[model samples]
Target chain A: MAYSIPTRQSTADIIFAQLRKEIMSLDLLPGTKLSEAEVAAKFGVSRQPVREALNLLSSESLVEIQPQKATRVGRFSMRRIEAARFARRAIEIEVLKNASENWSDVYAPSFARCLDAQRRAVAEQDTHSFQTLDEEFHALMADVAKAPFAFQQIKSHKSYIDRICALSLKDAAEMAVLVRDHEALLTHLAAQDATGAEAALRIHLSRIEKTIAAVHHANAEYFND
Target chain B: MAYSIPTRQSTADIIFAQLRKEIMSLDLLPGTKLSEAEVAAKFGVSRQPVREALNLLSSESLVEIQPQKATRVGRFSMRRIEAARFARRAIEIEVLKNASENWSDVYAPSFARCLDAQRRAVAEQDTHSFQTLDEEFHALMADVAKAPFAFQQIKSHKSYIDRICALSLKDAAEMAVLVRDHEALLTHLAAQDATGAEAALRIHLSRIEKTIAAVHHANAEYFND
Candidate 1:
């Protein structure tokens, strides 16, 4: 067994992480005003840390700060979501292309474990863990491609798409579909079929369009574009 | 002519921009110690703004800040450079493939104009302007691909690679070679030859390897890996 040392997080970092989670989870609804004083009081800290946290969230575009006015959770924009999807697809295609060529038997066990864990998450109706497993699955693919930084870049774009995903009404169904996509993607990679892998990955990613449409229909008021 | 309004910059933003330019241009050599008080005095500002500037640079990996110890310019790492290149190449290749399919006569005149300006920059041996033109050439290709955001992402990674390019000794000759490569890429795009365009881009970006080798020989002390 290995023990990992816990890294320190600044008060601001802690505040930012909590606020970001709330925002992404849609607990802090879009257009909801964020007050530094209230956040500071809730966190039992000074307003300085709250302001810093807000600034960090603003950089992520999760919050909008109007210098003299007020800060608020960001509203969904189709334009930003589309742009994020475009960049994500481009990088993932490249990663998949490489992964198909570099597929090794060494990674099979890890893939199997992740898939089994994903299935368990689906059965247990654990959407959050399922999301984590989905990310790990894609991340494992990046490892297979030997381009971890490529996934780092993908994660940056994913936050935008995730906002829409969070608005989704059916968690278990979506998780199951996503699991199936992963299974298909892995099968294509197992066969070392670059073309088939690319096609599978595309089909996997294109599911987001249906997600966006469904979420928009269900939560039209939350979107601005 | 259309008039565009200039956006305001905060004091910290200005300091960050100037320091980034100096570091990228090799005026501030890698691993050079940076003092908050000294930089404040140099920029005719207070330590607060200087600290903010250093924080911004730290985010870009252009500087390293050790809390309560010292801050210094980031040293070159072949690992980081290669990672940046891999991401850049993947995105650029996707952009080129799109451009090859979406080529239009309307963009031809712009390409010709950019190529001519690049040539003029080479004739005058103006490395700064030449670098700007090179970015513009790439940006235009992204526009042709109808994926301007892709280029935005590429520019983020290009800063990492620019450090090495700044170290190259042959300014004019390098500019000439890059300009020629841009011309070849444009020719391939005009012919709607995706394979040729991708090949040309690979050849163009591969020049960085030679630049890296030459710079490593000249400035071995500035590198870490």
Candidate 2:
């Protein structure tokens, strides 16, 4: 989905969303200080809302708050990253298995639509759009399986993975590989082959392992050991 | 784990924790109005922190905030409860499978200790302690599997299940069944039987479906359809 600016959120909600996006997209890099006073001034709000926003972010582990010290964008936590990967893999595999069992002709069109959008994104070299479509593809799987909540967990755990993917997307070949993985997964699902679909998904998700290593080597300073 | 009152928390943090406990324990019953002025006065803090705390709770779906309307303890959301259940079941089953594979002699003592504590809680008729121990049992499984993050997801999705469980715990027989389920699960784990452990865990988690029904029947007002 395209990131539409929220129009009707509370001041604190707006600040939280903006800061969360910046942090997840790595615009506010790890270890970057977030001054409450400066953020308040920049958002044209008081420190109360700014502090509230920071507290919200801290809860998500996107920002670290130290008592009597400055708040900073959280360093990439390898443990949390691994946890996210594990949770995503487990949930998506389960979802794919369910989708494979319940596969119908109606689901094929949705998969094709997402793949078509993804192919366009690849040709345009729009990594941002590709990333959004990538999420949509997985979300469609969960939707087909009637397990929308699985997508919520995946989305929650995906921030870390997405940030790493953001860095890895500079390699155009990576996007092509992702599109191919989606095709393979769709083929398996179309055949109602749960085992094959799961295998395809395992390979699809494993791409992140290599991406994590590549991203970490290039941006070691952003990570926590 | 013992619910240690946080000693080194900010004003907002303290309020959030206090309100969260009250809400989760059903001390602050669903639909109870939470006025900012009243809460601030009750806590002897300013409204700023109170608003922040409410915002925090809102994020967790423990409180509901509507623009230009008073905030209140959220009505128990069945959809959210089901979502939590689905996520918890998927993650825990995966954790159990992993724990079964990595089962070692060293892991038996931890499960036994938790079971021992659970037995004590049941005998003493301390449902609260039983609840805590129940969480410890599952967390220990995740810990043994070397997937601590899985426990985090479980914990995060558990608050809804937990609140429902707290309501259901008035039935003494229910607690006995839970302890028995733990014993059964532990037996499978000790035997390193992954499939058997998964089956045990599934049955263990399925207890909540009945509890949800019973709790809703007894306390219909607390729930939303």
Candidate 3:
């Protein structure tokens, strides 16, 4: 008979998402040991689901599972991080090109809303809220392009990047720079200048890449060390 | 204390890779339950490492984990498979464009080598071998553009498409059509015509998409039914 979608996801999926969000938000630190029994007890589920959830996280590279040893929250690898950032930049360039060619008025309000949320987050100086808003803004751009799946890939890649960015979350001034870039991109989108919009997006994406790298270098001890 | 820069990852990562290869190759059928203790016993490791490997598979969406229930080989989704095909086509068009602009003689041999491999695979009637070579051919194109990461995304998408393709492996004549398309793409890539190359790549991707969709419709029972 007909029923709700069943969340068809196992308890492991639920546990995995909860832990992943914690890891992504830095509620769980990198190098933190994720004991299966402990997690199982905490969630009041069997160690099996916790084990399954941890397995999923390991595949995402968000956790490290060592043989005969403990599984830990994943540490940052500068090289892998750089590679992901580069891929994101490359793919977004092509996406921006598509957006430029097919600019739409439908996405403007979404952009405005994300921008407004960003403004509110920054004005409040709440790092957590600002970062969340930042993700929404980038997602809005992808949605504006009418390719939500592409944005999903972008979000996954961004999630990898996000774990690291969270390490340097105290940079409020830099948030302003990102806000400016987003505004410029929104402007280009509004003007329907495909060429202009692409140029702005490239610059905007580059700023993010550069800032991320710089922060990583500045605090080398916080990463793969 | 140096040990070849740890070229070998942890056992969990290694097992995850091996299992992923098997699943992608369809040696592991959809809906097959993977027992942690059994797999661990087979790998001569503890359940801890095996659990981690399964987690990795789950993250890739290659395995399905049920909390306190069972972790099975991932089932195919027609919608996810379609999305992956579309994404691959979208990105490859841009990658082909990049290759055309920066066409080089250095990668010609590499390209031809993959093409020859595909030819050999076709002659031998080995669909599995042919698929690997097909992936290599697309990879070579991305290398020509000096953007190897582009192929990484393509492969990720290809995995989703391949799960569906596994069931539709009966049509030798249709396979022949796909081979011809690959040959045409190679011809255009060799000529360094950005416009022509992209057009060919788009045609190649679209054909596969159409074929795959047709197969999916005809065999809906094999999918997420």
| Candidate number with greatest DockQ | 2
Candidate 3 residue runs with Cα over 4 Å from true position: A1-18, A32-50, A90-103, A120-127, A170-173, A187-195, B1-58, B63-73, B90-103, B123-126, B147-150, B170-196
- Best candidate, TM-score: 2
Q: State what share of the real interface contacts each candidate retains.
A: 0.41, 0.72, 0.41
Worst 10 residues of 2 chain A by lDDT: A163-172
- What is the C-alpha lDDT profile of model 2 across A1-225, one tens digit per residue? 968665367788789989998988778888999989999999899998889889989988889987788999988878888888888888887788788888899988888999999999889899888888998999999988888888988898887678766665555677899899999999999899988998898899887787788888999998887
Q: What TM-score does prediction 1 earn?
A: 0.90
Task: Give lDDT tens digits, candidate 3, residues B1-225.
Answer: 656665558787778888888898788888888999888888898988778788767767888988678999988776576557656776687678778777877777887777777667777778878877778878877887767878887888777777666666645566677678877776777687776776777677776666577766886655684
DockQ rank order: 2, 1, 3
Better of 2 and 3 by TM-score: 2
The per-model DockQ list reads 0.54, 0.67, 0.36
Q: When superposed on Cα atoms, how far off is each prediction in RMSD?
A: 3.0, 3.7, 4.6
lDDT of each: 0.86, 0.86, 0.75
